[model samples]
Target: MSLLDEVKNELAAITDDSSLAKQAQVSTMLRFGGGIQLVKNVPVVFAKLTNRSSAAWLKSSIMEIWGYDVELRKASSTLATGETMEYDLVAVTREGKRLALQCGLLDQRSHEITGIAPAHIQGNIAQVKAAWRGAFLAKGRLSDPGKSSMMEIVCPSVDSVNDLIMAARRLGVTAKPHRVNSSVRVRITDPDVIERMLILMGAHTTAREWSGKRVEGETRGKANRLANFDDANMRRSAKAAVEASQKVRHAFEVLGEDIPENLRAAGQLRLDHGDASLEELGRLADPPITKDAIAGRIRRLLQLATKVEKQRAANAEKN
Candidate 1:
């Protein structure tokens, strides 16, 4: 199963500590996952849940906590879902109105409450967490931690987009809103935030596994970078060695026996060990020296050769 399915299963299995929290969860789920309507002048609240467990949980929560009977039905697959049918939980009762009031979906006078509702359905942290859990169970999806660390949710409305952002903020994780066509999306890209949110939603085991996956990904990335860096360094060293051999040969042609004894020895060592590193070349010298000391002698030898070559060019021009 997908990581999202795991989280949803875990969320659907959660047990609420209070009826108020359950009510908040139910209200949020109904608002985001389905529609609240008046069918034949009677209040009807329904949710379309992708996960079977989530659908069962919503239906049972309404029945057991709110004392409302919900009919769970199989919904036809849409083209957008690629023929994956979902479950529908339809609850028709006056209690739907009460749940809407608590969630600020409707006012005391039975009017629709538009825009983002005031945060925290019951002004309690548990209510906020449960409400967020409900929204996630309804619409949230997470990418595999081994591939990418991101969570995205389709909000029912612009109001819900902000509601989700506020809810996430209350939990100390930042969620950004994005608009794609007519739908609003809440995106959480930070791996830390995704892990923390999963934990807050009561998916502790999934969160831990996700954390391990993230760390493994980072470690693998770092090792690849180090290996690439070493490859680049080796390429540079090989190029430098070839270039030094050419310059040392040029010195022998231009400055010949005129080269200083110490400098000539350095140039000869470079010519003999065409593929050796500066440290190895230093050790191969008759009088062993440091890499830096041998390198200095070679630099002087090349400079002397360049000076003579420049003078020879000037003499040829004059002649």
Candidate 2:
């Protein structure tokens, strides 16, 4: 199963305060998942989901908590890729006075906070958290922590997104919303915020797992950066050593025994330890010297070598 499904399954297993769960579940489904339509002149309320676990949870929760039986239907369609996808649709009729009590719960919630406004919901933090949990089970999705830090919910209504933003603010999480195609998407990018939200949604295990992945990914990224830096420094040092050695050879070819003692020492050290850092090369100097001091001598030798090469070019042109 996908990570999202895993989280949903974890949430589905949580059974406490059936009343609160039902309220939150209904509100969430209404905002993010459910639809109202006429089936043979009778108003029908339904929640359609791609994941069987969520649909089963919704079906079982509605029956177990509210004592209302809902009709469960499965429909399938083939994609352009020739893969067939199955959808679960759970529906209840408005016709039966048998479901009147359940329908009343939905209607009452719809009238009071139909727009997804957390502020409009009566009660304390538990209610707010429950609402968020239900909404997530309905429409929430998370990117793998190893890839990116992203958690988002797609809501069919602007009011629902607004409600989500307000609810997150109450939980001390900063959430933003934007339009995606025909829907509004509320997204959270902070790992800490996502973890907190997941816990609020009753998916504590998933939250901990996500946090561990995030830590591992960050540690790997930092190690890669440090290794690249060391490699770049080594390349720079090797290039400098090669150039110094070439200059030293040219000085000897031109000046022969007249080459300066300091330049000769610098050249020999570089040739012997081409991969060594400047500080390490300096330590091997006779009477040991500072890296800056050795570097100065190397610079002078290159300058002299350049002068000799220019003079030879001028002489060749004259000849």
Candidate 3:
């Protein structure tokens, strides 16, 4: 099963606290997921869904809250893998139109109101949670926990998504909206927020499981980054050591046995350990000198080589 389905099923199993909360859920479901449509001069409220649990939950919420028994109709379609089911929970009678009108889904003449959320549930926290839960049931989708950590809800319009964004603020989470044709998608990319949302939507078990998986993934990513850091440091040290050894050899060619004894000893140490760090070179010194002392000696040696190269260049130009 998909992560979304797992969460939706978990949410479906939860019971609402009050009728107001149930109404709030129904309101968001109608506004965002599905809405009122005129069918042969009758206003019918429908929630077209691929998730069975979500469809069941929405239908039951409408029934439980306002005594509207939404009809469940199943449709089949063929795909590359196999046949799939699209569950459409529809309310076609006077009860259906009443439920739609009560939820502010329809205005008397059934012109099909769009992008408006009911005012009754906005102030209450439980109602807000129910509203979000219903919206998710209608159209929310979540990526697998360890893979992407994205959760999104498809909404009816820009104003419809904005209503959810307002609701999200009450839940202490942030959401962004994107438009796809006439519909909008309310998106949450933060893993922490997604887990929090799952908990608020009454999917506590899935929230905890998702949190654990996200933490594990982040830990693994950090470990890999640390290993890469170490590898880069080693490569940088090796390159520096190789360049230092080359410069020290060139200085010897210019100055011959005329070099200072201490500096020559430091240069020889660098030549012997061309892949070693300066601290390691210092440790290998005859008297166990400090890293700074070894680095200063190498710096002076390279300066001497540079001076000789400049002098040779000027001499050749003069010639």
Candidate 4:
């Protein structure tokens, strides 16, 4: 299942007080999907929602909360995959000149609904969690943990988006608001914050699953980085050993028994143990010398090799 579906299913499994759940459901719908519209010159209050199940839940909650049996219907559209997807538009009617006035969608100066405003969002953690859950149910999308950390909720009403930001802060999740063309988005990016939100939304199992995947991905990344570092180090050491062997062979061919014993020992150790690190070569020295001491001997051997090559070139020219 998609991460968004997993979160919604997990939320569906949560059991909470009936009244609080209804309040939260109403709050979410109003902010994200609820609208005041004119139908046949009659005022109609409706929630145009995407998820059919969530729309059904909203319809039921509206009946229980306000004694209204709203009409529910499918608004279908063709997808890019040529699959049909239905949007549930739950609408209710009441006698009023303006639909916004009838649905309490007007500014607070004219209308205010209990349990749906920002003031109602404070002082109760359970109620606040439910409210955010409600808003998320309307328009939430969570990215897969295996890919990235992102959780977002979109609301058509700017006031509702503000309500969401406050409610999230009350739950200790830092949510930022931004405008996306006609809609506003409350986005969260921190993995820790996203996990906390899942837990608050009553998706404990999904949160745990996401955490496990995040940990495993991080562990695998570190292992790959370490392996690459070791491989690069080995290649560099092997290259240095090859160059040291060539210098040592030149020193011996020209100096023979006259070669300094210290230089000769360092060169022979490197030529025999081409894959060994400089530290390991130091340990293999007859006197068990330090890496710096072995390195100086190799330097001297290179210098002697260069002089021997120069002398041979001079002799051949004279001949």
Top model number, lDDT: 1
Question: Mind giving the per-residue lDDT tens digits that candidate 1 earns over 132-159?
Answer: 8888888888887656678888888887
**How far out, in Å, is residue 48 in model 1?**
3.5
Model 1 ranges off by over 4 Å: 37-44, 66-104, 114-120, 146-149, 172-183
Please report, as a residue range, the 10-residue window in candidate 2 with the lowest summed lDDT.
96-105
Task: List runs of model 2 lying over 4 Å from the truth.
Answer: 18-20, 76-86, 93-114, 117-120, 315-319
lDDT of 2: 0.74
Number of clashing pairs per prediction, in order:
0, 0, 0, 0
- Ranking of all predicted structures according to lDDT, beginning with the best and ending with the worst: 1, 3, 2, 4
> What tens-digit string does per-residue lDDT give for candidate 4 at 77-175?
797799987778777776322434433455446453422455347637777887788778878888776567788987766667777888888887789
TM-score of candidate 3 against the unseen true structure: 0.81
- Candidate 1: clashing pairs of residues: none
Tens-digit per-residue lDDT, 219-311, candidate 2: 998899999999998898789778767766777677667668888788778778877767888899998999998888877877877787799
The residue-by-residue lDDT of candidate 3 on 1-319, one tens digit each, is 8767788888878774678777777777767666877778876677677788777777777776667666877765566578675566555456667777787787778556666555634658998898888889888888775677889998877777778888888889999997766667999998888888899889998889888988898788889999999999889888877887888888888878877788889999988888888899999999998999999998888787788779989999999
Judge candidate 1 at residue 151 and give its lDDT.
85
Residue 274 in model 4: shift from native, Å? 1.6
Count clashing residue pairs in model 1: 0
TM-scores of the candidates are: 0.81, 0.85, 0.81, 0.75
Error of 1 at 21 (Å): 1.6
Model 3 whole-model lDDT (C-alpha atoms): 0.79
Model 4: how far is 167 from its true place, Å? 1.7
Whose lDDT is higher: candidate 2's or candidate 3's?
Answer: 3
Candidate 3: misplaced stretches above 4 Å?
40-42, 63-96, 108-111, 116-120, 143-150, 169-183, 187-193, 309-319
